[model samples]
Target: LIQTFEKNNDATIRNLEAWSLETGQQVYKINLTGAILFVQINTDNSKMLVATNDQYLRIFNLQTGHEIFKIKNQWSDAQKEVTITPDFKEVISIYKGNNLIVWDLEMGKVKATFTTDNPLACYTVSPDGKTIVAAEIFGKLHFLTLEDKE
Candidate 1:
């Protein structure tokens, strides 16, 4: 399953669409509020993570289009990037103040936080989900290895 977003007019329509490659059919669609900044599907493709301009990261069940939970930004700025771990246990978000936060999906609590000197330009989790590479606005890239908790 593949997911994509669509924009309508000036409003950022958060359309979570799942397309079938075999038949070219849209199997599922979930519309969310706020201007979406980022969207990521869990490794198992059961859930989706969406970051919007409303300073919140929301999780939704793709199969039922039901929202599972949302992580509201504690700071004044909104989240810039978000991704889910391959194990589908955690969600990582980079806030506007260069704050990197790891959230436990099931527990609904922050697992860890890292402060950076420069604002984050972008970030990507490694395919194996053991590491994360984030680029700062000053053009410096930082690599972080995630520790296994259990």
Candidate 2:
């Protein structure tokens, strides 16, 4: 698994970098000023999606160690979760611990907002985007449809 060890940087992230899980070789690195909330490897393995407390879900080119796209939030709300679509084209994240944000990975902007009975503490999406299974800490399951949630 490609894991992001949150740097000790309470103010500025100093030791955040990428490493290959199989070989343990340094893949790439970057600088940041907040905690890493998410890291997702693309299907093609060319890049990864990173969500930081700085409110930017950045797509980094693994080969060059450069950011290709950045989705910056207009509000400084605390970003909670980040997930990249199976096709590696859409970026989804959570805002205010309750709002689900669908971001166009290439455009880096919000495309949709979904509301649930409770905040989306954790969620999983099928590769085909047909089933979205989510769970909160209330010991219940939240079923969602295309237009309405139940």
Candidate 3:
């Protein structure tokens, strides 16, 4: 899958395209709002989580191209990256260069937050969704463990 952007004078428009690597042809395109920052498809390829510059985290049904959930952000910094747990119950995002946010997919609310002094560059969730390794711009790695408080 490939994501392409179309720039206009007002806002940056985004188009999500699925391509065929073997035939080198475009399969289909899905038009989306705002500038997309990160996209993460679920393990089953049935759903996707997209984070955009418009400060919205959207979850879409990949098969029907229908939006399932939309969560708006209150912060100012752009989202650096986003990932979904294997169970598709949680969405984790890194932003503001120093903050990590975990969102509950079903409830459409923030579940937890973590902050660091250094700017974060990237992150990945463990296969079991129990741990997160976030890399800082200064070459430091932070390992975070996720727990169910409730």
Top lDDT model: 3
Model 3 regions more than 4 Å off: 1-13, 17-30, 74-79, 136-141
Q: Per-residue lDDT for 18-61 in model 3, tens only?
A: 66567787766767666777788877888878777778888887
Could you tell me the lDDT of residue 110 within candidate 1?
Answer: 88
Provide the clashing-pair count of each candidate structure.
0, 0, 0
Best by TM-score: 3
Q: Which stretches of candidate 2 lie over 4 Å from their true place?
A: 1-14, 18-28, 74-79, 135-150
| Model 1 C-alpha lDDT per residue in residues 82-133, reported as the tens digit of each score | 6778887777877556888888788878887877899888888888888888
List CA RMSD, all candidates.
Answer: 3.6, 5.1, 4.2
Which ranking of candidates, highest lDDT first? Answer: 3, 1, 2
Off by over 4 Å in 1: 1-9, 15-29, 74-79, 135-142
* TM-score, every prediction: 0.69, 0.68, 0.70
Scored by Cα lDDT, where does model 3 land?
0.78
Report, for every candidate in turn, its global Cα lDDT versus the true structure.
0.77, 0.65, 0.78
For residues 1-150, could you state the per-residue lDDT of candidate 2 as single tens digits? 344564462544444577778898877667765566667778777887777767767788876668897767632445455666677766666666666666667777776777667766687777775455667657556654332124
> What is residue 87's positional error in candidate 1, in angstroms?
2.5
Give model 3's clash tally: 0
What TM-score, to 2 decimals, does candidate 2 have? 0.68
